[model samples]
Target: MTKSPRFMQIKTYLLDKIESKTWPVGRRIPTEAELCEQFSVSRMTVNKAVRDLVNEGLLERTPRLGTFVCQRKAESPLMDIRNIADEIKERGQLHHSEVLSLKAIKAPEDVAMRLGIMLGGDVYKSEIIHFADNTPLQLEVRWVNPNYAPDYLAQDFTDKTPNQYLVDNCPLSAIEHTVEAIMPNEMIAQRLDIPLEQPCLLLHRRTWSGDQLISAALLYHPANRYKLSARTSL
Candidate 1:
């Protein structure tokens, strides 16, 4: 296995602390000198870690001011799964999507385990940027278990939402969702028309049909413009 770099490891450690709330938002982190001593690395290494986190929107730095933990944005609920087109229609807005990529690829280890398949199993991947009223809303990255949806790549995603197509073609039993807050990478930032330092809401979902995993998806949305909601009953 390829080990992460020293700077990356440091970044992960700091991120874990932030995520675990050890260092809450608006709280200043250890000074550069302090971190260099704690990690037993040079100032350059510590600076790199901290700089990357700032670029990733996990930390904020001011000139002459210390670096502080960033506050997590209020996330909307995505408890209920809905088609993007339907969502926009319900809100009386125009919905559009551009197909970025659609092809078959070998599933990676993480994706394979989630789909309950071999690491190199065949899977269909689709990437699309969903828009509302000409403004980018979400970046939809999906992997379909070909066993369930054989012709997944042949459909015209520009005309129909993937959720709509799946609902029409595949029988679904249950769906799993994992939502998180993250900073957009260069690619995602460019696609979503947001700054790389802006935070984004990531929704990772897996759909199952009759005990079989059907699809896994990563939905990315700009935090400032997009919000999700869900209703639950006791």
Candidate 2:
């Protein structure tokens, strides 16, 4: 096997320190010169490692104070159907949700296509806003196949998220996701408490349970306040 890159090795060393709390958040890391001496590497190699960490949001550079570990951006896995509430709780923050609407409705054309149902078929629709530490984080507009989740509209979303309830009833077997960045419309802007011109990330997701399409959702988040990340190894 080929040897790993020198910069990658240095990066891993720094990451190990941060993850172990040997270099806790807000604690300034050693200077490039110091790292270069300690690793017996060139200053350019040390700079590259630190720069990569900064770009990845693990370290931040101060004008004259040096680099320090910083609190990471709120993140969700791009390839996973994770519960927003659980993610917030894992970060040691409070999670709250508000149900804007929940009722049965005739499936709209787009919703019908996504859920693989008739255009006018009966379906359950719900709109909810999830908050992390009372700051709006996501707006979820979902349409569910009544056959799969008959009691979807009856449950209180504030007490439990739609995702949580769906998992219990639907037992997700497959999921599809499409992500894009777009300027929020008036209502989306107002709900997310951001200016209309500010860009937002939109995730269109469709889920299936045992080969039956169960639910489709449009999830929106403020671009600056939330991030999506995915990791994989061969």
Candidate 3:
């Protein structure tokens, strides 16, 4: 296996200290000069590591107050289909979600076609914003075919992740995923706490179980802070 880069190693070391409370929130970390001495690396490398961490919301630098350990932001692991809550917990962070909207509504033309239902047919619509350490990470907009997965709207998403609940109850037979990078709109920007100009990765997915369209969802994540990778066997 290839070893991790030195910059990444520095980043991980800082993050581990923060997560372990060795560097508490608002605690000033060593200065760049001090870090350079400690790590025996060039100032450029230390600057790169600190700059990346600041961009990632892991460290806050003030004009003269210096850099301090930021409150831990929630982190999500890249793994095979797993619950977002579980991902956050694995990182030792608090997970919370807010239901921006949840109701039964008529599907739009495109959504109806995707779900194989009439444009005016009833569909359970839900919009949720997931938070890691109180920072929004994902904006989820979903539509459920009530005929296949009834009582979807009544479930408590705070206690159980939608993916976990659906897998356990609906047991999809096939899943389709489409990913793209696009600029986020004002609404999505507010929800994800990203600048409107910042690009976001939009993941559109549809699932089927026993020939029935089970669910369709759109997941949005800030581009600079989030990434998705996969491996396939041919």
RMSD of each: 14.3, 5.3, 5.1
User: Model 3, residue 1: displacement in angstroms?
Assistant: 22
Q: What are the runs in model 1 whose C-alpha is more than 4 Å off?
A: 1-77
> Model 3, residue 97: displacement in angstroms?
0.4
lDDT of 2 by residue, 1-234 (tens): 997889999999999999899999889999999999998999999999999999988898999899999866689998889999999999988999999999999988998898999999999999999999888999999999999899898999999999999999889899999999999999999998999998999999999999999999999999867899888988
TM-score of each: 0.67, 0.74, 0.71
How far residue 199's Cα lies from its native spot in candidate 2, in Å, is: 1.1
What would you estimate as the lDDT of candidate 1? 0.86
Candidates arranged by TM-score, highest first = 2, 3, 1
lDDT: which candidate is best? 2
- TM-score preference between candidates 1 and 3, better one: 3
Once model 2 is optimally superposed onto the true structure by TM-score, how far is the C-alpha of residue 90 displaced, in angstroms? 0.3
- lDDT-sorted candidate list, best first: 2, 1, 3
Candidate 2, residue 60: Cα displacement in angstroms equals: 8.1
Better of 1 and 3 by lDDT: 1
lDDT of 3 by residue, 1-234 (tens): 998887778878888888788998889999999988888888898889999989778788989889988754444333346677787778776889998888999888988988889989999988999887888888999899998778888889877777877889888688888889999989999999989999998888888777888899999988755667676678
| Model 2 bad stretches (over 4 Å) | 1-53, 58-71
For model 1, state the Cα shift of residue 4 in Å.
61
Give the CA lDDT, 0 to 100, for residue 191 in model 2. 95
**What is the TM-score (0 to 1) of candidate 3?**
0.71
